[model samples]
Target: MTFDHNPRILFLYGSLRDRSYSRLLAEEAARIIAAFGAEVRFFDPHELPIYGSVPDTHPKVQELRELSIWSEGQVWSSPELHGQISAVMKNQIDWIPLSLGAVRPTQGRTLAVMQVSGGSQSFNAVNTLRILGRWMRMFTIPNQSSVAKAYEQFHDDGTMKDSSYHDRVIDVMEELYKFTILLRGQADELCDRYSERKQKGVQESMSDIGRMVNNVNLSQM
Candidate 1:
C-alpha cells in the first residue's frame, strides 16, 4: 500500500539535561527516518509536569497528546537509570491516556524503543519501553538500540559517530518506517478487539435504554 503523505512519526526522549544522550539518540533516529521520507516531530519534555500533577488541559499535556494522535508511529528513547527506563520517559507515556473519549491515540501505532547507558551496554531501558508500548496497544518493532557508554558514541556536535550502535539505530529507524508504512492503512482493522466491540455495543444499548426512559417520562408528563 502507498501513502499519500509521508508517515508521521513522533519522538519522545527521556531527559532534561543539556547534553542528554537519549535526546541525542532520538534526534539521530529522527534524522535517519526523515531521510527515509517520514515526517518526524519531538515533544520537548522540559516543562511537562509529572503525570496527574496537573489537569490534562495543561498546554504541555495537550501538545503531547495532540502529537501522539497526529503520529502514525512513535519512537521512545530513554536513558537507563538504575537499570530501568527513566521516570522522564514513563511520565511522557503516562500523559497520553490509552483512550481519549472515542479515540485511542496510540492503538496500533508502530513503536521503536531505544536506550542509552553511561556504563556497559544494557537493554533494561529498551526492554521496559517495549513493555510500555505493548501496554499502550502499540505495535513495537522487533529491532531496538542500546548504546553502551553513550557519551562516547556521539560527537560534540550531537551527531552520532560511526559505530555499530549507530548502525543499529539506523536499522531500527528503517524497520519502524517500513512497519508504519505497511500498517498505517490497516492499523484500525488490525487492532480491532472483540472485547472492546462488545463493550461498545453494551454502552450503546444502555444509552438507548436511557433515551427511551426519558421519552416515556416526557410522554407521561
Candidate 2:
C-alpha cells in the first residue's frame, strides 16, 4: 500500500550537557532523514524528569508519549558511559511504555540506533539500544552508527564534519526511512497476535454481561 503523508520520525538523545555530542549526532540524523522526505522531531531530555520521579501526567512525560504515538520510525542516539548506554537514554525509553491503553506505541515501528563515544569506538550503547527496541517490539534496522572520538566528529557549529562516521549516519537514516515506509503501512497485520485477540474477546464478553445486568436492575426498578 502507498502512503500520502511523509513518514514521521522521532529522535531521542542521551546527555544533557552544555555541548552534547549525542544530541548533535541525533540532530544530524534528523536532518538527513528530513532531506530524504521524512518528517523529524526531537525530544529534549532537559526538563524531562527521571522515570517514576513524576506521574505519567507530567508535561514532559505526556510529550514523550505523544511523540512516540505520532512517529512511524525513531532514532535513538546515546552516549556510551561506563561501557553502556547512558541513563538519560534509558530513561527516555522507560517513559515510553510498550502499550498506551489500546495503543502499542512502539510495536512494529521502525527504529535505528546510534551512539557517540568519548574514547575509542564501542558498540555497547547501540547494542543495548537494539535489545530495548526488541523489547518494545520495534523493528530495528540492521544498519547502525557508532561514532568514536565524538568530540572530533562534529564541528564547532554542532554539525557533523564530513567523514566516514558521518557517511554511516546518513546510511543508517536512509535504511530507517526505507524500513519505515515498508513496515508502517503493514503494522497492524504484522503485529496481530492471537493472544491479544483472545483478550479482546474476553473483554467484550464481560462488557456484554455488565450491560445485561444493568438492564435487569433497571427492569426491577
Candidate 3:
C-alpha cells in the first residue's frame, strides 16, 4: 500500500524548566522531521494535570488523546533524572490509555525515543521510554539519541550546536520517518492477533448464553 499524505508525528517532551533541554531536543527533532516532509506537532505538558488528578474530559487530556489518535507515529523525548525518565514525561504517557474502548490509539504506531542528560551521557530515559513504547504496542525504531551535558550541547538560541549528538538526532529522525511511511498503511494487518480475536469471540458467546438463560427464567415466571 502507499501513503497518499505526509506522515503525521506527535512529539512529547519531558520537563517544564525555562530552558528545558529535553524540550529543545524535541523541537530540533521536529524540525528535522518537518524538513523530511512530515507533519510534526508537540504537546505542551505545562498545563496537563496529573494522570489521576483530573477526569479525561479535561481540555489538556482531550487534546492529548486527540493528537495521539490523529498521528501515525510519535517521538518521545525525556530528560534523565535520578536514573529514570522524568515525571513530566511519565505523566503524559500515563494519561494516554493503552486501549480506548477496543481502539488502541497507540498500537501499531511508529515510535522513536530520545533523551537529554544533565550530567553525563546516559540511555536511562530513552530506555525507559522504549519499554513504555513496547507496552503500548508501538513499533519503536531501533535508532535512538542520548545527549550528554545537554546544557552545553545547545546554544543560547535554544538550538543544538554542530556536534556528533546533533548528527545522531538526525539519524534517529530519519529512521522514524522511514518506519512511519512503511508501516502507516499496513498497521491493521500487522497488528492483528488471533488470540485477541478468539477472546472477543468467547466473550460474545458468554453474553449470548447469559441472555438465553435469562429468557428461560422469565418464561417460567
Candidate 4:
C-alpha cells in the first residue's frame, strides 16, 4: 500500500529583518508541523515582486502563485510593525488575490495565522490576517499563536526557547492539518455555489442539477 505522506504547508513570514522575530516564530511553527508529519515549506516573499511592481510573468510572482496552488494550507506570520501587521506582510497578502486569470488562487484554501510582537504581546497582526483570510475566501483556523517580546523566545542557534509557546504552535498546526483536509474535499463545490457569477459558464450537466431547467430546457441549456 502507498502511504500518503504529503500535507503541503506554505509558510509566509513578514519583515526582512536579519533577525526577524516573525521569521523565528514561523520557523518554530514549521518545525512542529514537520514533526507532526506534514511537509512544510516557507515562502521567501522578499524575492516576490509587489502586486503592481512586476506583471504576472515576473518569476517571483509566478513562484508565489504556484506555491499557493500547490499547498494544502498556509501559515501566515507577521510582526506587529506598528499597532498592526507590518506593511510588508500586508503587501504580501495583497498580492494573493482570489482571482488569477481563470483560477482563483486562494479561494477555499485553509489558513493558520500567527503573530510576533516586539513589545507587549498582542493579536493585532493575527486579527488583521484573519480578516484578510476571510476576504480571500480561505478557511482560517480558529487556533493561533502570538509571541510577545519574541526576541527573547529564540536562541542564537535559531531554536525556539519557550515551551508554552511551542505547545501553542503545535496546536495551531494540528488545527490547520484538520481543516485543510476537510476544506479541500469541498473546495470545488464550495467555489461553485458561493461564486457571485452563478452558473459561471458551467451549464449543469444533468437535467436534474439546476434551478428547474426541466428535462427539455436543461438539455438545450
Top candidate when judged by lDDT against the true structure: 1
Q: Clash pairs of candidate 4?
A: none
Across 66-135, the per-residue lDDT of candidate 4 in tens digits comes to 8888887899999987688887788787777788777887888889999988788899888999999999
Positional deviation of residue 10's Cα in model 2 after best superposition, in angstroms: 0.2
For residue 95, model 2's alpha carbon misses the true position, in angstroms, by 0.7
How far does residue 145 in candidate 1 sit from its true spot (Å)? 0.3
lDDT of each: 0.94, 0.93, 0.92, 0.82
Q: Write the per-residue lDDT of candidate 1 for residues 1-221, one digit (tens) a residue.
A: 56689999999999999999999999999999999999999999999999999999999999999999999999999999999988899999999999999898999999999999999999988889999999999999999999999989999999999999999999999999999988967988998765676687766665766688777856557
Give the poorly placed runs of model 4, Cα more than 4 Å off: 1-5, 194-221
After TM-score superposition, the amount by which residue 19's alpha carbon in candidate 3 deviates from its true location, in angstroms, is 0.8
- Model 3, residue 133: what's the lDDT? 98
Task: Write down the TM-score of every candidate.
Answer: 0.90, 0.89, 0.89, 0.85
lDDT head-to-head 1 vs 2, winner: 1
Off by over 4 Å in 3: 202-221
Residue 118's C-alpha lDDT in candidate 2? 91
Q: Rank the candidates by lDDT, best first.
A: 1, 2, 3, 4
- As a TM-score, model 2 comes out at 0.89
